[model samples]
Target: MLVAFSLAPSGAPTDSVHDAVAAAVRVVRESGLPNHTDSMFTTIEGDWDEVFAVVKAAADAVGAFGSRVSLVLKADIRPGYSGELTAKLDRLEAAMEQSDDPA
Candidate 1:
């Protein structure tokens, strides 16, 4: 999947934005989703489910700074018909669900 997200804090200082963005990206990537970030945006590619989950994690990381945060996310679930790519992500979700199941 391909995604573009933008974040701007409501009461955050400009100097802190870069660091905040970087930190958020780090958190998302740590979630097992690959992340690519530039000055003001982060692009993440991964399983459809994990993509959403990673964005949520990134938002949490941003919130950790105690600054009002905002985010925009875009994703493409139809990258290709080839099973090689999509299967990997599907497997990831299956693993996550298995790990999360309580019963």
Candidate 2:
């Protein structure tokens, strides 16, 4: 399973969300799962239970800093598939390089 999620504190007392984002990202980084974090989202790949647990913890971390919390999640549940995170992109790049067709 691959999950890309964004968590942040809504109704925050201040404009800067770095603290809240850092807190949530801390949870993901410590989860021992293969993961990556970009500006908008953090993507994690792991078993269902482990991934959901990390998400829950991350949300909890964000909730601590604000009156309301927001979580946005997108998941690709490709059963029997693993390492699609990097593999998919690798395949696309390979195809692009090999193609002789003019763009």
TM-score, model 1 to reference: 0.62
TM-score computed on alpha carbons, candidate 2: 0.91
- C-alpha local distance difference test of each model: 0.69, 0.91
Worst 10 residues of 1 by lDDT: 79-88
Candidate 2 lDDT, tens digit per residue, 1-103?
Answer: 9999998798888978899999999999999888899999999998789999999999999998998988999999988988987888899998988896577
Candidate 2: the clashing residue pairs are none
The numbered model that scores best in TM-score is 2
Query: What TM-score against the true fold does each predicted structure earn?
Result: 0.62, 0.91
Model 1 over residues 28-101: C-alpha lDDT tens digits? 66876556677667777766777777777778777766567788766556655334334666899999999999
lDDT of 1 at 73: 68
Whole-model alpha-carbon lDDT for candidate 2: 0.91
